[model samples]
Target chain A: MTQLPVRTDRKLGLVIDLDTCVGCHACVISCKGWNTENYGAPLSDQDAYGADPSGTFLNRVHSFEIRPDEGAAQLVHFPKSCLHCEDAPCVTVCPTGASYKRREDGIVLVNEDHCIGCGLCAWACPYGARELDRAAGVMKKCTLCIDRIYNENLLEQDRVPACVRTCPAGARHFGDLGDPDSAVSQLVAERGGIDLMPEQGTRPVNKYLPPRPRDRIGADSPALTAVAETASGFLAWLDRTLDRLPGGGLARMDAPAKEENS
Target chain B: MNPAPSVIIFTTLSGAGFGLLVWLGLGLPGVTGLTAFGFFAIAYLLAVGGLLASTFHLGRPERAIRAFTQWRTSWLSREGWTSVIALILMAGYGAGLVFLGTRWTALGLAGAAMSVAVVFTTSMIYAQLRTVPRWNMALTPVMFLTLSLTGGALLAGQMAAAKALLLLSGIVQIAYWKLGDRALAGSGTTLATATGLGAPRAVRAFEPPHTGTNYLLEEFVHVVGRRHALKLRAIALTLAVVLPLVLLMLGAGHLVAALAALCHLAGVAVSRWLFFAQAEHVVGFYYGKR
Candidate 1:
């Protein structure tokens, strides 16, 4: 059925800590490597060694710069995938009944056999989570590493998702988010984790722990202020020369003029 | 948002085809035998041909039969079902008119209703997509329904209805354009909400996920030039509504009607192109394209 389950037994999802993620993309590489090898089809690359190389990826890392109202700008590495929402729009929008949310684990999966690749499910998703694999002619998405998560053959410690296991910075954490006492849920509570696009009403199982307050390190730094106060001789001359250039030190120039007039 | 030619053709032709069926089922021309057959043939050709064109963009077109199974939850599935049922009903109604020279009022009325339902479902397929705020509105369905009816009246040679509808469609088109321009901003979804980042306007996209274009960017982020869009809208409005009305008023002769239909079709085609080209998908926010 394309309709989502009324409820899931356990909301198994990932907790990504933005504070700790170093924007390394190690998880992305590992996810691609493991999924292509073990899952349904290989993530094919078009023009792999040439100009304009593009390919299907289950995970991607995007960097964004956010400036606070009164502080220096900060760079945040956003790793996005299927949120496996309580109300997964992608699942319900599938015409072939190929996209479904697992009632047991709350993970959304695509049945390659049933998918007609109309891409309607992809359109319904607010997050760019699903991609139509040109080679397989099927919709591919984050499976939450279903193959390895419960595999008896793999070692117990290796049962987690490849991305989670391969993350060097330990940025990605996976556990039963449905369980209030789970470590992932506890982490979310402690760090004030937030849902991406909560107004979209996806009710995503995955949570993002926001970055901690950053130190004062830019133009308003105490060290820079001290250095500016002690400017003298050749150093002061160089500052004045640079300040006089067009569009240079305009704020400072305006400040002195305003003071003189007042 | 790529404005795939197949999709443009599909929506335009199919909407017009279904609209024509609506009038035929209402027995406006009241033709029988060969004349009915001729009209039915054109309707079927446009509607069926357009439905086929829609499948061209699918990755697995061979598996399209599976699309009919999920009508309960999927609007696309509902559209498929409604279109098929409408075609079947219209087929029976047309057969009765052509072979038996009979007009079954109940069957014809049912077919007409279904035909209108098919167009409505089709519009809902786009309208239901909240990700594309421009299409997710009451006006989308209104525009689609009005255009379909207006095009139907023109083809059926109903001068009064066609004239009234053409004027209405023009107003609706202008209103849709004016309102759709503000839809994304009105939806209150910005980069900050999308990423849960800084103040809504303060966050900026520093880098994309990849250097080369991926499926998301290729499929969603289409940039149409402002001047070109304005020129096309002018052309569409002139040919689709204005020219057709003028030709009909001058004389609804066979030659003039045919010319009018051709012009209207070309205009609708341009309008359909703008429909896809102008739509801004919310996923574009991640790449700062929005």
Candidate 2:
């Protein structure tokens, strides 16, 4: 008779640091490269370098400029993918039981063979993590590099996911979230990490460290405020001189004026 | 939200089908000849046809038989089973009307109750989806029942006026219009509660994760303007409810009543389409699209 494995209270997940991330998009690319070659099917693109190109991607990075009223604009890059929630709504609403949570590690995954491509699970998900692969006739999502993470041949530290290992900024960390002593768990507890949409009540396991408080860039900065002011002042002076001259101020009509003379 | 053409046709067609059944059941005692039997057959055909059209919306149509198995957990399964029962009841009621005469009041009354139950069950299908805030309200069921009655009464009134049964049809049509208006306005808060993120605060989306549109955007992220929704609602109410009421009150005959029914159906189709199209799914919060 086959024996079942002993139950353990251990859940492995990711913790992302927003302050150190430079919006490099290396994680997104690495995830796609690994999953496309390793997973059930490659993320198919409708058009390559075409007007209406669309395809499925397991990860994406969003860039936003967060400007508080009192401080300078902070360019925040948010890397988004599946959070692998403890109370994942996507698994329960699935009528066919195709989408399920792994009892061993708390990783949520889809059994593509059982999925009918009905898209009901996608509708039930409040996080927008699931994507339907129209060409493959199934739903696709981030597996957190399941094939690479558990390979025994690799060294213990090298068993990290493609996204976490490839992150140049060291912003991504993966470990056992269930253990209070784990580095990721400690960072979350100390840094006051926040869920993206807590009101949705999905109870996502992944946590995001809040962006560091941005310092105000003085109006003296050469890139934006200083350059804009100088350019506008010069333009205004030229316009006033041009108005004083005969026939709209230019000696030659319809011919471009030299920058030095103007 | 994306309006799948199949769903639009299914709900609108089924509304008309069930609406026709409700009217026929109400008027069985008063009407006679080929007219009574004709109305009965038409209602049965529409009900079956609408049910069939709804099946096209399922991902696995071949496995549709499994839908009947989940009545304990799924309202969709309940609607399916109840509709079938209602059909059988209508068949028995139709046979009695043809053979046993109008004296079979008990059978007629039972058929009417079943028809009403079918409408109620169909509405509950949407009302039970807890994920969708707009569809989970009590008004959803009330709207379905009222709309069916309104549509059925209008059709009956037109048919009766054509056969010179004016007084009876007129009364039914007027009653349906009033009930429908109240139901439409009464359900506003339910929709607001579904989408409203209480107390206005600036929640800016800095970056979206993906460059391309995903399943969530394709299914639920509709960007219809506020002004457009208001204008469409006005058009729908006027064409569907107001015009029909005025025309019927003016003693319009069967042909006019038929024309009014068509206009009302078109208006109801737009209204129903907006009901699904405008519904905001809470999942958009993750993508930062809403």
Candidate 3:
């Protein structure tokens, strides 16, 4: 089971648009809530109410503040889980016949019954996707909601992953990335969705849509050039420009508040 | 990565055990029925104890038997299987050496092969970790093999062989650490590359995904203090390699050799702690550690 199959029929994955993501923990919660009771062992929480609360989670959202030189600072929210790579290091590092990638859809998973929870699989993963359940003594991870997606017990519309289904901003898209005609593939092609850490050679199934570049300031908006050359000079014009300014000057960064270059 | 005590003990102790068994199997001189009994007893106790210690690292020790299954890709699996082969062969060879005064050459050779093979695979377990660039060196296996052979020679009281192998292992260990430290320092990853911030710019974490520690933070993000690491490395080298070489140079008997072997192991243990402690996992980049 450690040896990966030469090929998989379809690569099922998720595409998350960083531009639209609201830095919400909904997807993380939904994944924990469902997987805690769904497919495998419950994701255990140690010291949930005590001083140090820690637990296993299949999904996480990392937020970063990136200050590009030309534009306003952008807050990039990254939602990460398993990439379910074709050449998964997590799968190969498993000493037990537990971690395996599905040949049908390329979903990397652990067989709780067979897992020894040695943590080698977790260590092997570059993405930190694999999480160990302390209570159950087994490794758990994003199953791509295999139980929900393929289950005949649910409606076809609700067959998508719990994270995708519960995303309020519609930032998460689930589909067959392998199929060229699939909607997710087309979205990836159009929006230039990129793989996280492609150098790792994980060939992660998930793709992240980069945040949209903010458009240059419009003509109607008062330009920084309109401000007077000196701080005292700007005090005279500040009253006039105050009405036209968005959300008042207090909420904004006044360019002319400081001394200007001679 | 945390230098779990169980793993550090397992790798070094079993490595020495197997190394000594290799010397015994290779038909070392002055190995009589009494000596053979002592060698086998020491080898099995250390090997079996180390293997048992590894089970404690597992979340479920009862299911450790399954670890012997997947040998095709998992170096850990290969280590388990190789240990079995080495132990079984040693048991058989020990029986022969004990009951009959004569040794089985073929069985001894096969047992020795398995013995060295286990240590090799054990090194591969760390060497193969692409996540830890410092560990993924060809030197890793060589280090393990040399250390095993050196320990074996020391335990068998082969003063000359132990001296030579100890020196070789010392040079190799220093070389490995030197190159490994450079490799870690020059690793290509950064917060920009990790988060796909694109265009070289300083990326800072505005807020962590969570307030409290998660499994990833606990397991993957071990930032060793630079001063502490330097001090430990000095101690490790002095104890593990330099001390052993100097002691063996005295050309003394089993008493001196035994003390040297003990010192070598202590040094190796300290070095092993640095091995795990200093390793920077790629996941650390995600946490903005590097």
Candidate 4:
């Protein structure tokens, strides 16, 4: 049962665009809301509203500061969940057959009933995707909203993962990555999506589109000089007014005032 | 990696127990009736007691029986199966020698081989984890098997084998530490690779995903101080191998052998603690903990 399928029928997964994520954490909150109420067990929190609060969150947003060789440093909001790897190490490491990857959809899930919470699956995961819920004493992870994605009760548009449905920036996209023609697959192809730690050889189903090259601001950039040189209309009048009021224009303030010097 | 006391006790005690079983199974200290009972008693106490101690860390120990089901792919499951089978085999062999006053050579040999298999399977539990580069090496099993054999020989009072194995295990232990130090770097898993942010661009964890530590951090991101680990390694080598080797060389008397066994167990426990505490899980790279 812990052995991986030769190939998943659908490879349903998320493609997160780092270029557009705003780090709002709406997806994180929505995932917590939906999974806690609907999943096998509620994601438990210890020391809630206390000095040291920690909880089991299926999805988490990590913000990183990345600096390119030539450009200004930028913050990339990295929202991570289970990647549902083709060769999911967590699945094979499970002694109880509790952790498994679905052949039908390739969604890695935990059978909460069988989980002894020895945490070997968590240890096997390089991504830190699985969290052992303190109160429930079972390993909790992103199920990719297994209930919501297939539910007939929800509206057709709402039948996606809680995180994907709730993402304000639309940074998250869900589709059949196994199909090269699928939207997520096309996104990966067009944007040159990359795998996290390909060296680990988990063969993650989900992909990340690296942040686009940022607009660089050099010391002599025209954008910088334009603002200094082209003070037009109201700005020109304000400069003249300031020139009349002070010993000289605002630029002259750097030097000794003419009146004081005299 | 958290070096949970339950796990340390489980591995160390069971390792020594199984090691002793290896020697006993080979009929190295062949005894029958009351004398066999004395040897078997210590073996069962260490092996069974260690197995029992392991259950203390489980979140739902009642469901632990289900862990025996998935042996096809899981090293942990295989470990469960192998340990149980080896213990049962050893029990049968012990009963034959103690109660029936018979050697049961075939049963003894099978149990000895199975006991070694149990130790190998146990080593693979950690050795199979690619996320922990330190444990994911061929040297890991070498370290485990040698240490187990060394401890077993020490307990069995096989003076010649104990001395040789102690020297080998000491060398293997040092080599493991030296090689394990370079494993993470050699694996080429950096903050860059972890985030899919390629090299040349400086990538740093500006803020953590959470304000407080979670299971991943608490479980995997143990940062043993370099000096502290060095100190423990020296102590481990001295106690586990050096002292026991010296004591045995001077004399393998009952008292000396007993003291050597105690020193070996303590040393192995400290070494096992370091084995876990110093294992840098690759997930720590994501949190900038590496």
Tell me the tens digit of each residue's lDDT in model 3 across B1-290. Answer: 88888998998899899998998889885365876798899989888888888888899899999998999889999999999999999889888897687788899999999999999999999999888888888998999899889888888778888878888988998998899987764666567666777754656767778889988877778775434988998998999889988887776977888899999999988888888888888887777774
Report the Cα lDDT for residue A223, model 2. 52
True contacts kept of 1: 0.83
Task: Give the clash count for each candidate.
Answer: 0, 0, 0, 0
Between candidates 1 and 4, the one scoring higher on DockQ is 4
Instruction: Candidate 1: list runs displaced more than 4 Å.
Output: A217-262, B225-227
TM-score of 2: 0.71
Flag clash pairs in model 1.
Answer: none
Best-to-worst ranking by DockQ = 4, 3, 1, 2
Model 4 misplaced regions, further than 4 Å: A218-262, B224-227
Q: Candidate 3: which stretches are off by over 4 Å?
A: A218-262, B185-187, B224-227
* Clashing pairs for predicted structure model 3, backbone only: none
After superposing the true interface residues, what Cα RMSD does each candidate give?
Answer: 0.9, 6.8, 1.1, 0.9
Candidate 1 C-alpha lDDT tens digits along B186-284: 887789888888687788999998989999988888885434888889998998899998898888688998888878888888998899988888999
User: Which regions in candidate 2 have their CA more than 4 angstroms from the true location?
Assistant: A1-12, A37-42, A102-105, A113-116, A144-161, A175-181, A215-262, B22-37, B55-136, B155-203, B210-212, B224-227, B282-289
All models: lDDT?
Answer: 0.89, 0.67, 0.86, 0.91
Model 3 fnat value: 0.79
Model 1 Cα lDDT, one tens digit per residue, A49-116 = 99889999999999999888886888999898888899898988899899999999998999888888
- Best candidate per lDDT, number? 4
Q: Find the candidate with the highest DockQ and give its number.
A: 4
Over all chains combined, what TM-score does candidate 4 have? 0.92
Better of 3 and 4 by DockQ: 4
